[model samples]
Target: MSQTKLTPPGPKGNFLLGNLQEFQSNPLKFLLNLRKEYGDFVQFRLGPFQKFYFINDPELIKEVLVTKQKSFIKSEDIQTLKTVVGEGLLTSEKEFHRRQRKLIQPSFKRSNILSYGEDMINTTLNYIFKWKNGEERLISEDMLNITLGIISKTMFNMEFKEGADVIGEPMEAVMKLGIKRMRKIVKLPLWVPTKQNRKLKKAIHALDDVLNEIIKKRRACNEKHEDLLGVLMDAKDETDDTHMSDKQLKDELMTIFLAGHETTANALTWTLYLLATHPEVDTKLFDELNNVVGSSLPKPEHFSRLLYTQNIVWEALRLYPPAYVIGREVDEDVVIGDYSLKKGDTVMISQYVMHRDETYFKDPTKFVPERFENDFMKTLPTYAFFPFGGGPRVCIGNHFALMEIVLVLACIVQQYQVTLPDDHHDVKPQPLITLRPKHGISLLIKDR
Candidate 1:
């Protein structure tokens, strides 16, 4: 006789909406509270039919993302994202994703990424140099703009400073609308003329127009450029000898455009906020920068020697991960740990929740950059500190993002002292498609 496995205990809600209202009101708090009350593997409902399992245990998360990853696929939110990004690497699946990854892998090679360091530093310097000493600015927007400029110049061999508004405004609208679509139980077709639907379409169109123009110009150019766009355009499959179509190029470019800058921007914003609030950490960081680079611009060779600088970024990521949650849906009936999950069931793993778990770090709620010193990462489970995610599907731009964050921070902090305004209030993390600062981070800047 076979033994029976009962569903894990979870918060019981009314028969109809079952946990949907609670989740939508505040997702981060709901998940944190759920873990505190229901333990590691808790099963809950979203709508009338959708089943969700929240996994806080590191081993179970590993199973879902790595060991038995084939049994699951991206969750519904990612499927929702395809409306904006098309079938790019972030939303693609199976063999197609593997193929695209292979074709695009070389552009992120160690040597290739090192070459982009100069552009990253120069872009940071140029943007920050314009800031008048003792001026107050929304550091969040500055981080976003500088990162957008860096990604554009390094990847596409083009400057985005003049067109920043063209991309920035519409991109914000798209991300806001994307989150709304993900949470709604009844999604209307894009063809429908509802106000939200029309707005989404308009935002997406604005983005499409900008990207399509770039793709068109790149295709028309005859020079064999060495940048990421050039590499993508010229790459040929080993077996088929076929290059990416314009549509495919646009999809990948859109994916990179959003992922390359937005997440890193948030990371840096949080980092600056953390540094502003914690003066001791900020002082140590400045000390490291002064000793390592010594009144010169940050270069690729200086990256490895800046251990404290890297730890500060790592700590920021641990606290406020840009992609706070990773969701997956079961592709087929599978068993994770002792739980029996049926096909169509969704699994949620939150880096925000996990990074703060007391089991992994001492004084989990506090900001302590020194926690990452002395090989602290090696002691934790792989999934416990997964800011870039894990498995074959881990972020392809992890290396690029890390290098950019460290270099940009080095450049700016060495030149300016970033401190919160005297009237600065606490900054709250806004849980969207990517985690961002609510309202925005306002800071006082002065020449160091």
Candidate 2:
């Protein structure tokens, strides 16, 4: 057997703080540099106590996420998210997680996903029509607001067309607070009365107030609705009468929004940015859309026919995966590659790193939708391009999101021509909870 006890080679940081300061400086650059210097697998310490291992190799990533997945749970980092979204699928552990997943899984099935198609396209086009030609729009905020509305309409039966800020603002505030709190060196207690803490508390209260009202109204209603909430509320297991309580339903709603909202928005934002920068690729996508989905408007039935549009989404996901890293913690002694990991160790597998590695993708940095045209996915390892992660723990919203993204892109492209700023330098990748544009992306559009 390989010496699983051997520690992977890595740089030593300060004895007291370990790598905490270096990590706090610029997480993306630091991690990328570490990979360049130490090769695929590298070990580092967060402080005197906490140890972390970064796995960049795809086959090794599959081993942890798929074959030996039972030995791990979500990383300790997501505990912060649990405070907001509660013990829904995103943070639940062991058998409870599995059970909740089974219950929530049906809402995103093919039939249900197809049912959502009308809402997805109608909502996107309704929002897009508000844009004026020659208007310079902040692409990031627009995408965030629109995707927030999409999730709300699709899941909760809410319409915030004119004022998505009702849901958008508080959620954005709370999410930013969560990300900020996650990076604290010595976290301030909630009762400390700091301005930041006070703001965070306010944000949480505001979000809770909205969620509480939605739950109350839904419970009071007798009429059935064709939305995710309706399915969740009516869901039952024949083996047992167990179903989500109102509070549990609220938790899962928050989890769905938290998981689905900004990530999909960021993804849409990046895809537009990429298309804007690459005119040739943009023309190809528009041509494909014109041929397959022109004037007639896009629906779920068109998903199969829009092959090139779907490929563009795949390539964009490969380039700028919204969830940059998938993190998990060891729950027991586990062997991964040549290293033995004890309980309490954190493991991170980066989609950003692997997707850009020259070893796997030729001309990895270039935008190439053609790469996805072939049976490349079959030839690649399961984890080589895992934007939604892998294994039993993979993101449940994968199919829904893919279909929604393709529909939105196809609908928008069929009628409008997107023009990007000549200088792409300002819109840098900001790795927060999602990979966002640091300065909001500036864009212009005209009806084609």
Candidate 3:
């Protein structure tokens, strides 16, 4: 192998900032434009030192995430995420990640996920039942609240009677701060006592307080439990039969606390927004729900039968995946396609960009649930439609998320007709740690 450097073509930025200003302005558009102007394997600099390779080709993405994964690791952004989530599954590396994932995998098993369906439906009904007919509501907030309630009940077997903001608020602050840290060229240590650092510390402390209390009470109970938390508590490494320590448990719980609800909430929020804007798709979804559920609440058994509903969810995720982009850093010099990426170079694969690529999806910008009606997925490359990502580090809760999205969408759309307010124009994606509505989606709710 030659120790030769072959960099892909990209924008020639100013000597100081590189592409930082453009990226900071709008990351989604910047990446999309990168693909449009520079083709699949594009390289760009953030500041003077940070080199990023944007991979749009499915095969190259497959190489980075699956085949040559050992040559790479989670990107610098995930490192910043460690401040909040600790060394949980999302942020852990190599063997520890494998071990943690293996231990946590069982909790999302089909049987365990099926058991969570009732809680999903009931939780959605509980929150939506409060919406007065003919009243306007921020559907994004509603989705967040309902999904938070569902996660609490299903993961902890505890009902949040007050509201979801208990966890939602702190989590929001932590995520915003985390993104802020990611964007900064010079990141101060968490103990630096700057205003941002202080806010992050305060938010993290609030989360730690909540999570520590949950673990404390659960451990005090001293009985076998069946929820996700219980499963994690009881999970043992088969090699050594070692159980996770309290800190380890708290980290995993925090990961789930954020991943479990926030992503699903955003997915549902976008799904409803899509449904409201696309009345034809909305009508088809309602028809499917009526035929399959028919005034009865959605159950786990109905999951498989609701094809169109599932398509609608899939389509929404394709258009507005909460985890909009995936990033990895090269561990060694590696050749992906024609480019030889050196160690420490960052690779970005954006679902937001790839999902809208004209190559995979026809009329890529349109909302077409029917596009998935046939075996459309089979026609595309494995990495082409990766909303949950692919390879070893793919989201653990993919099944739980899809099922929750379908059941919740079914329960809500079946009972209520969701429409945008007369003055409402559009909701832009915020592109935080998770893709959220920049302006919370406002919808007019009415009885079916």
Candidate 4:
């Protein structure tokens, strides 16, 4: 085993659980404060089983996630997600992940995603019909429904009215259970006969049923379409193999469905909420959008045209990053900066903290979209603003998510003005799978 100093310049951790308690309470805030107190490197123990070296240094983070990626593996916490996502790209082994990523890559081509633009526009308009004039809509739920619909329509050509709530109910249950487990309020495994375990099983079954039915219908059809499922059905591997098995297809489809909607929906929701509260930003964005797309729906061609609007999206992602934290484990003893971590030691790159690092960003707390206009943004260090993560395992549906967010934002802005019902309510972020508003942001939507 390699040995190096374990010393870090920070408050010593608690003897029992180290800093796990504070971490569990409000992880995003805790890490932000911890980084403030500890500087770039902090060491803590996760229970008595493992040690974690939280590295806030950008260079060191790049080394682990990019340059020295082969020396590390997805952390144990990520491994726990295998039950939910299966051995899909997100939680699979290095070789398996590589193979799956290669296989699934063609499904997310720009052309394929562009073909789904009409579906996205139609879905957004469908949701707009549900909004009552001057009704207080929980923007969180509204955004969830919108993204869920978009994912269903674009990915599988399913109708939002017919499909979203059905798939969403189980997903919500699974997410609630998952968050509870992550918080350690419940400690039962999947095989256990407890209530949470049972609910997890049921949720899994419900989602499986929905995906299986969709898959079956697609398979039975004679002709092919340009949606995500069609691309997956046509994807070819290295050995000239074509087609994913029913089981593989189901797992990947469900993974994309949940991940596709949940993360992007939370991001768009936060973006709108932020814009609603900040009138100057809102008006600036409105002017930009009006100039770019006029009174029409957004298209792939308009993405580059709305440069300022895109910057606002980037800034919002930095402030309330959907993929809050990414973790990895040292496969062998290694030195990161001045700290040494043993094999099996886990490390977290908290984007919540990293994005807010005052050293990297001026006035880190402010939402200034213009910062992205700097030439250095294209050359910014890795993990500095990795809302979608970094390196090989970066989110595959990134372009799709971006396209959806821009289109959805454009659609909503064209029809309604959003404002928080109560201006003084605390708008804290709660980090689960994605960083979401702790309490739902209730907004009154006035027709434009």
User: Model 3, range 290-342, lDDT digits (tens) per residue?
Assistant: 89988778888899899999888889999999999999999887888877888
What is the TM-score of each predicted model, taking all chains together?
Answer: 0.95, 0.95, 0.96, 0.94
lDDT of 4 by residue, 1-448 (tens): 4456767765456777777777777787778887888778887675655677778988888888888788799887667776776777777878878877889987787776777777887899888867877988888988888888888777777788666566767777776766666556336678888877788788877777877887888889989777788888888786866667888888787778767887888898889988888889888888887888888776667766777778888999999999889899899877787677779888888888999988789999899888998664777776687888777878999988888888788888877888887754788888877788888788888887
lDDT: the better of candidates 2 and 4: 2
lDDT of 1 by residue, 1-448 (tens): 2453769989887698899898988899999999999989998898788899999999999999999999999998798889889999999999999899899888887777888888888888888888889999999999989998888888777666643665666677887887788777678888889999898999889888887887898788788887788888888889898898888888898888878788999999999999988999989999998899998778988988999999999999999999999999999988888888999999999999999999898899999999998899999999999999999789989989999999999988998888999788778999988899999999999899
Q: Which regions of candidate 1 are displaced past 4 Å?
A: 1-4, 163-173
TM-score of 3: 0.96
lDDT of each: 0.89, 0.85, 0.88, 0.80
TM-score of 2: 0.95
Off by over 4 Å in 4: 1-3, 185-188, 240-242
Ranked candidates, highest TM-score first: 3, 1, 2, 4
Scored by lDDT, model 1 comes in at 0.89
Deviating ranges (above 4 Å) for candidate 2: 162-166, 188-195, 423-425
Q: Give the alpha carbon lDDT tens digit for every residue of 1-448 in model 2.
A: 6766578988799897788888877777778888899987999998898899999998789888999999999997786677667798899988888888888888888777888888888888888888887777888887877778789888887786533656777787888887788777677777799988898888888998888887788889899988898899988765688888887888888899899988898899899989988889889988888788776888778987888888889899998899998889999989998889999999988888888888889999898999987788888877888999988888889988888888888877887778886654566788877787888798888788
RMSD of each: 1.9, 1.9, 1.8, 2.2
Error of 3 at 76 (Å): 1.0
